[model samples]
Target: MAKTSKNKRTFKRKLINKYRLVILNEDTFEEKLTFKLTRLNVFIFGSLFSILLIVGTIFFIAFTPVKEYIPGYSSSKLNKKAADLVYKSDSLQQIVNVNTIYINQIKELLTGKIPEVIFDRDSILQTFHVDRDSVNLEPSNQDLEFRQQVEAVDRYSIFSEATKSADVVFFSPVKGTLTDGYDSQKRHYAVDIAVEVNTPVKSVADGTVIFAEWTAQTGHVIIVKHAGGYTSIYKHNTALHKQQGDLVKSGEVIASAGDTGELSTGPHLHFELWNEGYPVNPTNYIDFE
Candidate 1:
């Protein structure tokens, strides 16, 4: 018991004992600085300083933007910016997808490549709430009279002829000798109108230019999409006056003719007319003499 009590007192005295630390100049042994500290005070000061340093480090990392540079650390502002960018990219992708689909449809129209459809006759009739038995099969008196009037008109008359008897009138793109006419079996869907080089080619109808670009087979080609689903194409042009998306009136000069393509034998206008993705004979509506 005495030995234990003596050890405890020794420990306590050691903790409370004061120590003097001095800094001296070695030449003269002159004291420049001194510190009187107890072991307990030194230990307390060290522990408090360590705790303050740790807290300061944590505060700086947590509250300041410097933490973004540290590994395994992220900033809330960066997260928000990343999220915004992701949403913007998603929206832009959607817009691009929609535009691609629209352009594909236009290309299909230009190429006359119609997608096949499963025709459900019953479903179509039911959707329109029509009964086949109740529908009139005979033409009315006015319809017969109109048909007679249409048949009496000359087939080659540009003023009377329209697209399948529709009211739209087509103007001739160019008036010249027809070197070649539309032949579907040979896959020649356009009339090769032999015209002088640099002759002005006009639009067939009031429409908007949908395509105007150089092609390997057609050279400088321009396409116009008109109302009533009619589209006209002019190929082998020296220069185009209108660009894609330009609105044009009927008979407006859109391009100058040239023998520019690999298929061209001489300077002429290769003109094609299409209605609802099917090529139509341009002579049926226009007098390209």
Candidate 2:
């Protein structure tokens, strides 16, 4: 107990012990500056200075742009850019899905894979108990007014004009005997016209050529997109004169007839007419004989 108490007293004396620091002029031996300091005082001032330096460093990193350079830190601008990229990726995925579906539909149209179902309209009307005598043929005042309004709007607006199947004028693609007519029961959606090799095939209507490419099954094939949702396809061609995106007038030459495909039996033109994605008989529109 005595030794411990004596050690504490010595430590306290050393901490409180004062020392004189003096700066002197060498030649004159004159004291220019002096300071009376203790060990405890030096330690307290050094500790306070260290604490202030640490606090200042922390504030500089937290509030300034320097924090972005440090590891494990992200900037607000970087976060925004990352979010934008994520949204763009999602949008691109949706566009890709839509394109895939569209391509599949085009494949079905080209391969004649669309299913055809025939239903009896007379039987359906009888089952529904629809009587022609009970139905009124006259239009009400409101219906007449709406029809007049629609007619007035369609007269001035060319884009709003309704296209009737009868209004379309189809030009004959070639002068040849029809070898095979469109048979939905046999899944034959096109008409095969027998013609000589290298005979020029004309467009049925004014339109833009949408597809012109070679295929294994159809050989050189060309498709035209006409106004009023009309699409025309020509296959088993020797060559396509008008490329894709080319505009063609009615009866303009677009391709040459040939037996170039695996399915071709002889030199002929396989012509197809589609309205709003449904195949229609070419004989109904244009005469090939």
Candidate 3:
């Protein structure tokens, strides 16, 4: 009975053991049924390894030299840079309007109508007045005023008052020291007789007073459009002796000379003779007699 009691107690103790019993397979030396790891452990390890792989791939992509990997970033950046340079260059000229004129022949230059260069630029700067380099365009020869004046010469005929007989005796326009000879510097296309104020101005020939008005450099000027396409101009006058559309005989008291407007250089007469429309040397006609 005591032995039976001892066996029963031993069986109960075995059932109460904390460690699990292992069954070893004789063929493989490994346990057939053993307490190893839980399914939860496997899930944790797999998740950690996956996170590490994703992090490594992201780092490689960011540092790689492949430009196409990122969307339109590189192309957009390049276009922006080019645009900035263009903007900067345009700002320097500060151009308002741009006129571009084109001329065919240089011989026809400045004689034809002033060619319109659509790119007429109006600048904000005062020092940037109308100059060759400052103007942002080219124009045809016919477009200029000077050229038109030159061409107009051939279109008209001057009225010759006499073949030999003279109705009125023509006289010199002014009594002054000749500083600039006739047609010198091309600026003084006429003879500049340096005289004092209100000097006795005379007409070179018998004609009429047509245009008596004030101009920029010519001051209170008188333009006598002659019988022929010939015209005579007396510039830099302080006063007018004749009115517009008035008739006067040769050697008549038409105008007195003074330094007015752009004629302020010591009170002189800027007298010009135009044949057809071109300025001819007055010395050619002025008998040095």
Candidate 3, which ten residues in sequence have the lowest lDDT sum? 97-106
Sorted by TM-score, highest first, which candidate order results?
Answer: 1, 2, 3
Compute the lDDT of residue 259 as modeled in candidate 3.
84
Error at 84, model 3, angstroms: 57
Task: State every prediction's TM-score relative to the real structure.
Answer: 0.44, 0.44, 0.41
Report the poorest 10 consecutive residues by lDDT, candidate 1.
Answer: 155-164
lDDT of 1 by residue, 255-279 (tens): 9999998978999999998887778
Which RMSD does model 3 reach against the true structure? 30.3
Better of 2 and 3 by TM-score: 2
**Runs of candidate 1 exceeding 4 Å displacement:** 1-163
RMSD of 1: 23.8
How accurate locally is residue 236 in candidate 3, as Cα lDDT from 0 to 100? Answer: 86
Residues 115-192 of candidate 2 have per-residue lDDT tens digits of 533433343434545589989999999999999988878332222212355566899999999999988667688899
Q: What lDDT score is found at residue 233 in candidate 2?
A: 97
What ranking of all candidate models by lDDT puts the best one first? 2, 1, 3
Number of residue pairs clashing in candidate 3, backbone atoms closer than 3 angstroms, sequence gap of 3 or more or interchain: 26
| True-vs-predicted CA distance for residue 183, candidate 3, Å | 2.4
